[model samples]
Target: MPVLQTVTRETFWTIGPVGEAAFYYLAAVAILVFLYGVYARISEYAAAPADPFDRLDDLPGRVARATRLLLSNEAQFDRDTYAGVMHTFLVWGFLTLLIGTTILAIDMDIWTKLLGQPSFFVGRFYLSYSLVMDALGLLFVVGVGMALWRRYGVRESRLWGKHTDLEDDAFVWTLFALGVGGYVVEALRILGTGFPDFETVSFVGYALALLGQEAGISPATAETVYAAVWWSHSLLALGFVALLPYAKPVHMLTSMANIVTRDEQAGKRLPGVPADLPPDEIGTGSVDDFTWRERLDQDACTTCGRCSSVCPANEVGRNLDPRDVILDLKAYREERAAGEAEEVPIVADGGESVIDAESMHACLSCMACMDACPVDIEHVKQFTGMNRRLTESGEMDPHVQDAMMNVFQQGNVFGDPARKRPEWTDELEFEVPDAREEDVDLLWYVGDYPSYDERNERVAQSLARIFEAAGVSYGILYEDEQHDGNDVRRVGEEGLYEMLVEDNAAAFADAQFDEIVCTDPHSYNTFTHEYPEMAEEFDYPVSHYTEVVERLVREGQLPLSPALGQTVTYHDPCHLGRMNDVYEAPRDLVRSTGATLAEMPRNRADSFCCGGGGGGVWTEVEEERKPSEERLREAVEDTDGAVEQFVVACPMCTTMFEDGRKTGGYEEDLEIVDLTELLVEAMEAAAIDGADDTGRTGAAAD
Candidate 1:
């Protein structure tokens, strides 16, 4: 093959002095408007309160990570492959075009104009640039086509949300015009040049030029067409730039900033209210109450309903839609910016509330929204803040208020006497040692549900049997243990949550143990993540029961017989799998029980909530269907009749699924068994009953 000759194109071939001057003047105005928009946005964000958790450490590392996520579209791809491909094409394609334009500007304005240097818009470089620009521009147009098709042709519901505006159309159409128009202008330019051999490197343009020639377009006419098309394309692009900050495409900048500054532990670990905060200002009452990062989150939202689509509350037809929550906040922010500064409530009852009380109460706080958000918006955190104000103002749910009162009066949500906390251990062959009185290797923090709820009490008993069979030295805080405050905190009762935390911390401080292990994922989450924030000396390592059980099974500490031979599906408790990232261990444990682990449609990180979190267990919301019922149906139907047993590690999941199993009439089809129950069955099949070394029936030998 012959070596291709160098090719170059004229930047202003058809434009006269007057046209060039007009172009420059318009370009300057567009640039100034763009800069002003950017500055105004930055100033608006800066004016908001600082995010307590938004630490600026490791900025370079953060930028690098954010760049990787943006370039790879990993998070977006994880949700939808079509969207991922379209977004990647659009981003990289548009970026390449922008870069090519910037290079042209540098060559013309900087190298030649300022330094009087020879223009480098020639030789192999220009040829390569032309080829790359043509190829990527085609991709850019394809991305625009895909976007339009997805939004309009396929009519993807996730793309259109409550806050979706005409601006969305404007953004997409402008992009479509610019991308297609650029190629049209290039084709016109090539056609005017008589389809030169070197211009073939701009293959799309060359092909279009050849087509135009075949259609009987003369060179003079092509030149005339080029001038008008070039001017239109340029102006369209400039107008897009000028309108950037005011349109849906503003996410282009805000998203990058949001992602770069995102808290990795956002939903998993929430920021607590400052002690000095006034009673009236406990939560986000108005626009001014939100942190700068949260305000940035509002702007960063691309109006994609990924968060709402994945939300269990929304999925179950509850009033809470995470996308609406963010967009509502954004609308309020804009309204506030436009001079509505009367300290209006963000969430209120029967008033001109930006977010309604029902929507606030409807949130499950399962972090499903946060998990689905590609822009890394902390939907859980934002809602939790709003909940604080609700709780402070006594506008919270009646059941939640009762639960809070129960927690305050009885140290548990069940309102059971403290003496009854250890009653679950009565039927067990072994006695769970009191951690306050005994020194043990593992301090088992038996959470409220396991200690009080009869069904979950059986699960706690099963765990006790497993501990006995494994010969693990574990003790419980029993009556001394208060509630973990995980759900309380999530429900927006920060003061009550702190009170519980302090009470639990005091119990922990008195307990003598090497490490703390929790039966409930909710308890484990707060113990491992939130507890240390309040209790500085709270240094004991914490683990969910699954982690400890998995280790024991791995170490051959538990007697194993895969004789169950049943097909089972594991329900990922949101706090365990999504919040804590302890997915594999429970699945491994299920497999270890000689059961075939059939996964549901959504599992692990994408696991559906059981409608038991964010005080969903405490508050009653009449919905078309419960999230737990939906989850059970998913397990029963989605697994193609393979799942006979629905195994879960969380007591909350057990409570919810059991209730759902009855309510959904799925009791005949599925059994909601806990991980500990399965483990006990597996060990019992191996002939290892709860027998101790001293032959005292594994009870506390007094």
Candidate 2:
């Protein structure tokens, strides 16, 4: 008989003043405890050796971008669509319910008590809010169900593979009960209120109320049951909030902070070592060596194992599980934060270490872990610091040591003399110009591997032929060239890397070139990003050779006749594609030669590593399968052997994949060819009259 306006619910329907007072008392304690937990976590972060919050160049823009990213759930969807949708529902649903509750509190306490206003939680506004809350609340329930199914039913591998405790499950179950319990309480309250017409707008609760009425529950009993359930639900939700900073649920807060504070240059341009820093402080060896941001990284980890799942080292059964590195550091951080004796090392050769030496050494530094991390944990940043410590302690792999020594003594990793750097060019019919002696449009920085490695030397000469065919003015540093030290820096020899940088920067300063180009993505990456940071005056423009070639072809500077006529698959180098966002140029070059590009399952930014980054080309690690071998199999098997040629842009990838092809028994199925070699083959076929087999003709032939 009542109108909808008169069908509103009270804030404290069944509870009297005493119960209300008691509820408020518990609420105060919960709020205080939550604040204390937050403070304690902040204090721990503030105590880290360095302040990692210096990225304030665009404070407002950073916050806005991070907020947009978090809400978008783009990172969550990067590799796992199922997990992405699951997390999206959970996060949005939780926020909706939270907002609904906060509105209720404002209506009851703030607006009604402080502002002396009539309650807004009634009639039209209330009905709309109830309907919205009920619908979104179902999202929370569905998300919890999906999580349970993924974790227990389907058993997602990414969620496993690490040591987990009750807290992990407890965090999910708490959300489950909180969401489910709220529905039950809502239904009982509606039934106890006699199922008023206005309350039907809360459709989920209304339907459940009908079920309760069908069960023949009396209004008196419904009221009593609702009271008990309401208290339990409220207490559980409050307790979850209070315990957030101390349990697995802490990722909720820390993940947001980490995303907001993440370095855009993270793995691309690593933090440099100071010139005068003491040897003991060279790298991260203890909890005290961590930065505040890195400590936040420890807390931000969800233990989802996404990092480990994507890691080339971990995938092939290397000891380097990226997820374990973070968790181990987190455990040690807590122990130290608890005022325990700091006797245990963060990383060591023995059991006293939280992180093992094998795991640290096994890292390829591909940044796949960082890319896959939804929370932006910067795994490479943390791992590189530890690597520096290992280098400082003389704990490098024997191969790594030899490579470092070679770079130090010979200005290259192959232990070859400087005069031999230009030996690869002697095979070319045309003489390659020396950059030091004359100005050129392009300074071809033929990196160490391409300069000296026999397998890659032919590829370098092919690029030189391509340059001659296009009539582009390009020159090499010749004997003046030194190693770029990209991989050396990744391997953590700060002093050696500095020496290499200094030597190369001097050559670069002396050379007269409009732009620097490299066939080595590793060299291109460091020259474009790290070199300028270390060398004050080394700010020359740099381009990958693929980018240069692709542009030349596009602009008709280099004519192509599409003479390849072969089905090929292209591999994206980590430094080029993922780290530097140069994904399409090399593929464009592959297509320029009239090759049919059959896409690999993992292409572009998702391309699998060739196991040659971070000095992986130098260091040897035993594994069930090498990452290079695994990738070769993917190109051959995933493409069903349709790919006759495996085209790569990087000299490092060329070296790694050539070995992989031979050893993995893919020699018959695939041929590992550099993009330049493939391009040169097409260019030679396109050459007109007076053109020799070397593709030089007309004015170039003269």
Candidate 3:
């Protein structure tokens, strides 16, 4: 193959004014269309504002973080090797091609006239640039090929079933043809015209031209073919632009936007419910209660099924599919666009040819979907919002309604008297402070479960022992504490959650605690992250017990006697680990006991839910086999030959694991303990009991 030189300015000018005008007009129209798409997207956001100021302020940080994530090695996965490599190539290739196009437009339309001639930059560099682009296009085609094969050939790739496979095939094939055909056309032009300046670098084109000559095509006919192919290729490029906004290709833009606008506090423990919220203004209680950005999350879902694949609930035969939830929202949007007369039932799930109540209730509200989604669609938040809609506006199931009523009337999910909240503290030797008279530095927010549940009181006592051993300044709300309503909120009792938040907030406001520590991850998550928005709310720093233990260990306030000599696996409480991103603190606390930390295949953000979140702790949903049983099996299997002890940080997780172990027939071999329990053991082993460990103590005993 003979390498051709690029064209000179005079030669470029003679390429025909009519063809140039067509290119310019098409470019202008494409730009206008792109601008209109941007306008529509922005307008949609404008209609709903949720934490706009926070999102805006966090934008730069999110971009930097997302870029780092994209470039970093952390996102690599062995199973999706082809998809990952191809996606990276496509992203980089498209970015460079867009830059090349912009430069081409400016050089041809603006720079040439202003400077009295198009600079040699484009022609001299065009061959090399085009060759690189052509190579990338080829890579993109390969990527598309693999995607198609995965969709059609591999039954396990769930991404195939959600959307039409043919649509994907068409989209991929079209892109491939455009890239290959465009390169071929351009190469033909260079060959038919003979070697021009800087044409040597167009490797693919040069190869094609040589191949053409070898086939004995006449130069005149080749020139005609070249021109026709070139026009067709350009038209295809233009067509892709017009089709982008309506097709899955739109994810190229929305994905980045989704990443940029992702919630910064995602995975962090939600703060405790505020202490001073008025009765009327509390938790989200209905469909209209959601913030606008939460609704925007519906549009942002890419329907990748990453959430579904990782969802513990869905994997264990639960009816809730996170992917389906997002798809339903997209379907709902499509229906709205079509101006369909029928109201698409948002909660139906097929038996009635409608979304069903079980589909919504089946969700454990684990937040696993949120953790797994690449674009950061807030699946847990969306599910919670829908739950509010069904439970508060629509009539809820009888048991669910009963549970909510119990929480509302009795201040506990179990319909127990509020005064029983202090009963757990009687087992401790120390006299815990009441919120009314205590000037404690830390207010232990004893949640309903640990306070009343027979097995959970041990967790509370363990927390107290750890607090005393660490010489920390802490006290408890004792009798003054009420249910924080996390269960009620998850179970769809918005009014109860609000009332609970108000009552708890009032107690805290009247008390003298500077900080709040919670034994329950659910309470910690809600109080630390979700409570401050209520009117007249006083913001308090809330810490999970593990976080407090970690802090104490770091400060050298608490000392371990010796290694526990036990191999233990840690289970992530969804609310604590996924919702609040408190994964490390608990693990760090576990390690502080000098116990060997073994991981389940699903640990940290990928951890399985214990089937006791989102008020599932209180409501009864039928399962072929219990979700806890499935989770326990996974835990036991992960540690089948190695570890016998499973340490959990959340009260609900503790309860679920205990029950799951019994159900799964592993109860005799496995032991489940709260993180604080291990810390208490470590303290006892060291024989370093503080004064309060054996006697009644004041708020400042530590």
The numbered model that scores best in lDDT is 1
Could you tell which candidate, 1 or 3, scores higher by TM-score?
1
- When 2 and 3 are scored with TM-score, the better candidate is 2
Against the true structure, candidate 1 reaches a TM-score of 0.96
* TM-score of each model, in listed order: 0.96, 0.96, 0.85
* Shift of residue 90 alpha carbon in model 2, Å: 0.8
* lDDT (CA) per prediction: 0.88, 0.86, 0.69
For residues 1-702, write the lDDT of model 3, one tens digit per residue. 122333332323223788878776886797678778767766766765354235656667888987866544134242346557766665565666677777766776677767678464444365566667667766666666665566667744667545545656667777778667856776677667774545556666667777887888666767777656777777788877876766667776776677777776653323223447553334343233335566556666655677888777787787778877776666655566567635544553343322466777777777777777767787765665556556645546667777677776777767788788778878788776565675877888878778889899898878877777777788777666777766666655666676788888888888887888888888887787656754267599988888888888988998776558888888888878767778888888877778888888877767788888876665566666677777667767766456768888888888887887887788776798888888888887666445444555555476
Q: Arrange candidates, best lDDT first.
A: 1, 2, 3
Off by over 4 Å in 1: 1-6, 340-343, 688-702
With candidate 1 superimposed using the best TM-score fit, by how many Å does residue 332's alpha carbon deviate from the native? 1.7
